[model samples]
Target: RVFEAMLLVGISFSPLAGDLVTLVAPQVAKAASLVFLLGAGALFLWEINAAGRWVWPTTIGLGLDIVVGTMALLATAGMDGGIASLLLINLAAGGVLLSLPKAFFFAGIAVGLQYLEHLLSLAWFGTAERSLSEVSLFAVGYLAVTGLSQLLRQEVSQRQQLVEQRESDVESLSQLNDLIIRRMKSGVLVIDAQGRIQRINEAAWSLLGNPSPTRKDLTEISPELWRRMQQWRSSGRGDYTPTALVERGTEVVPRFVAVPQSPHHSAIVFLEDSSLLTRQAEQLTLSSLGRLSASIAHEVRNPLAAISHAAQLLAESDSVAAADLRLLEIIRGQCLRMNAIVENILQLSRREQSKPELVNLRRWVVEFVDEFRTVQPLGGDELRALAPETAINVVFDADQLQQVVWNLAKNALRYGRLPEAPARISVVARRLPETGQAVLEVLDRGPGIAEKLRPHVFDPFFTTNEFGTGLGLYIARQLCEANQATLELVSVAGGGACFRIAFNAQPETLRGDKLPEP
Candidate 1:
């Protein structure tokens, strides 16, 4: 469009079409030059055949432009006419649309010729020379225009560079986020202002058991979920909590806070597993109870022993019958059962709340593996650690951290073993570069969680095992969060599970703070 406009201006200014040509002294010369320019354009077009090679056509066009440019110079003995400026327009067009270097060379020629024409007319021709005042004004105007154009060009170049750089950054961040989401056990959803699905990360798609699709309307695509989300939004500010919406395939969508970055314009919604958290809480409660039971059992054992001794003495009496002896034995058996319950309560209550300490993560994980080996009965070969032994460190409650490790290791030992691949557990610690957060992962070669149960796996008292109080994992999770860390389930590539803990690299070591008594 710009090219066409410049061409029209050139034609209008040319003598053949202008009214001033009739009375002007240089009318004949101008008329002849205009004819030559027109013929050059026509011939250039003719040489470049239609529907054929474009290279020869472009070459011919550039050549005709140079020839006409030279003729226009001869026609203008003085630089009185604004013909030179037209050359600048052509140069810019050529540079933008064709090879940049070639276009620059042409522009250089145009500038050089204009300067030569001006110098020659002043030094020799004496044709239509300008007064001193006019000359000063023209020189100032020309320099000012030139400087302004250069400034604009520089600004345009800088803007282009900045835009490119921002695009690259956004792309890199997007890819990294996608990789992380795909490796998560929880589902994530992102909606636009109009409740349209701007993005659904890999986990969300997989959880829905759907193939990846792009640019779909959230409401039209998933009406149920969309309605639930609307309800969540309508619930007002700071009222966000995890809600379970039973969906197709028994899917549970947990409440995740929707951060309002814009004013009711847009936000992100995260769906985590509430049932899992509930299971964890149950485990914590049960474990506490178990510890109490154990303490009670210890306290009762002395009395129970005395009672059993007295019963034995009574049964041994010569007057006592065989039936009486059987009754005494039954009483002793019931006492033994009560003793076992007490022991469980004690185990549940036994939470080691020692002072938190800063420990080098590399050394700690190695020590933990060694400790696991001593307690667990491995048949023959030693298990290996997959990650590096770097000098990573964190300040955490050591006793609580130990319990977390123990539960993860024990779970792996029980469920991860297979004939082909013997049971193995790996404790790894690494830092997240973006957030500079420390993450610990315990990977196990165990049967991956079932899709249906994955969401509820952390609920307290929710056990798949007959003997399980289901409190071990729950307590671990609670302690982790209490210490300003996050315990999460990471989805692995193969049929296995990974439990990851994300904590601040420089965590507050103090455990003096306590929750208000209920």
Candidate 2:
């Protein structure tokens, strides 16, 4: 539009143009041409100041161009002065700003104005018939330009919309990918070609032992792992062997893979904790064992019961020798032990869904200790209950929690008693302020567990004592987990073992009802 305005300004100032205009109307020709030039200049300045707002300027500018061009053509006696084609600018502007139908409408207006100018010139100045042919040709050119410009504008608009839609989709996909990566259990790290960390997820940051903010060098983190990564990259192999990176006694197994079709030559590294992998494997094994135990328990319990019945019948007989009776008693004991093992296995296999309720931890622990002391032949001072100052409520199944506490207390009494100290077991219940979880600790002054054996303490059927069932801690931990709690053997500051059960202190609404104090 600005270029068209500048061209018209030059044409109005030309000496040849002045002579042609003088030959036409002569009275109002120069005045109309000057007004047209000034109008075009004003339109150009309006467009320049319009900035990003093109719709209004384009619409008003097209209207002004058509009106001024018609006036100029009329002043110069129509197409005889050759200014009729200037109206095409209005058609082009309309096509770019408005719709195709509007562009054709403006073209029709321009053609009609030229025809009007032709008729006026013929009436006043009796201009030659050659101007009619020029008017017809200009109308045809106007229609063609309007049609082509509108088609091009429509195509560009469609392409722009498609590009915008694609960009929006890409942004949404990128955000979703980031969310999944952040929440993933396995740690993720994006490394650049220069071996610098471009991005690291929360899990990856934790797996890295949460190194200080200043530490960015992979070599500084783990030189052995960095060397292995470098070797794998340089080897140009399709696959790299997984390696473990140990930091501060925690092992993280890292697997690296190149980013597919990446131009930046980057790679994504996945880090998984070794302990987590072991736990998952153990869970899978337990799942299989649970399925197998159902079948095995039925088969083993029948024979074990028959043996126990036969042993009881034989014991009643007085004809047996003393040595043979002792042997039979041993057999009976073994049979009972085997039957107990089958019963425990069956119990473990038949895991019931947890039905949690809110219980006052302090009162529950005190009552449980009182009941336990009454049932067992222990001194009053041997077992004691220590409650928190304030009432702490936790969500758990009362029966399951009671069984877990009993097992833990029994283990504490058995292995926690030291020769130097008197036999004493303390069941302490308190709420941890930092984590907001209720903690129940069954502690005794026995020799603490060796650090080497702590990891396998919760394993099923693992025992250090010959007469131990070994499933007590395992069953306690399993029950705790089912109730969304944890059972761990934490080493006490003093020389003793502490079996801590941490309960999730969910609100009353989540656990149904809060039980009254016992």
Candidate 3:
């Protein structure tokens, strides 16, 4: 458009261009040039918005230029020099707009018109001093332009293709990089100089506790992570100190790397889950412990059985005095406790791999509560169960799930009571709406686990009660993990302990037995 406009502007100012531009001069018909200019302007208008639709407009422009050039030549009394050069410019423009075959065809028409004008000029003016060679030179120039433009067009086309291919390759690589980053196990966050999260991967968002998607600031999601990032920036060292949203959550260890100077981002931060590494180490330790317990099982059990059996026999003899009866009772109680400890260790060693199956938790929990109430003494205590009417399917070992719930309920009944108050236990089963996971929560009206001890509550051999075996919670957690479930000590707002078992989401291709219909 600009090229055509500039050509029209130059034509308009041709009179100022003097005799060298003979299209308009002192003796020339200004009206004729005006007509030619109008025709050119009209052709330009016709070409508007047809650049992508290449064929028709270029043909129209070429034909118009040929007819108009011939008129200008004849009207200016064989002004071949000026009209010929102008004709060359028109040919070059045509060559650019049209394909080679059509362009050459138009150039031939202009050549033919040039000869026709020269013949008429000779007859009218009765012999002029112009030779055939001069007219032929203009003809040569037209063909040269058509050829040169075809070459220039081809070169420009190859370069354009190269550029487009390079752009496509760059886009593919960018998408691949994004996919890799999103799938990475370690969390990745790109931060700008203004402390904005310019880019964050799925693992990073999840590690930061899945903050609101619209929150772009780093500090808004996890302040501890932001602080650690600042500390690492100042010292320029590996800061592997773990950060967690809660005491029971997996700890994330973040590492920072300085990115090259960029307007959008200043650094790339990587978050590694230290909890996975810790769990691997813990698994090794437990495996060894399980082996050792199995090795000492026979030796330990024989002695424990003999002591417990002797205590019962001696008590039944009646030769035992009343004062010694208390001592006997203590001895028997200690023996029983020892035997219970031995039994727990054996259970840990002999623990089977989970055979996860689909179970309807709603019906299961109702039946579980009924059995629990029948077996356990519930003196002055309240035991209530709430389950959703709809079936809540979960992937778990039915036996293990029952055992875990039972232990949690027993603990709730035993210690979930305030002084001079009855214990209140509630077993609720429901499906989580957002994640489609089944949840079985056992809540009590007892003092919740202290914040300081919350982290270690699931650790083996860690307990506050003198008579309590710490293995209960630990074993329960192991069983849950074996079934691809999670057990956490949830903080209750009503001043009580609430243990939650978040079961694995229901399978899409569930094929096992469901709770035998209704």
Output the number of the lDDT-best candidate: 3
Q: Write the per-residue lDDT of candidate 1 for residues 222-331, one digit (tens) a residue.
A: 66666766776787543235543435443455443565676645656666666666667866776676566566667887897788777778877898887777888887
Please report, as a residue range, the 10-residue window in candidate 3 with the lowest summed lDDT: 20-29
Which 10 successive residues of model 1 have the least lDDT summed? Answer: 19-28
Clash count per candidate: 34, 1, 0
Candidate lDDT scores, in order, read: 0.61, 0.77, 0.78
> Cα deviation of 31 in candidate 2 (Å)?
8.8
lDDT of 1 at 36: 53
Clashing pairs in 2: 416-446
Candidate No. with top TM-score: 2
Question: What TM-score does model 2 achieve against the real structure?
Answer: 0.73
The candidate with the higher TM-score, 1 or 2, is 2
**What TM-score would candidate 3 get against the native?**
0.57
Q: Give me the displacement of residue 248 in model 3, in angstroms.
A: 15
Model 3 score (lDDT): 0.78
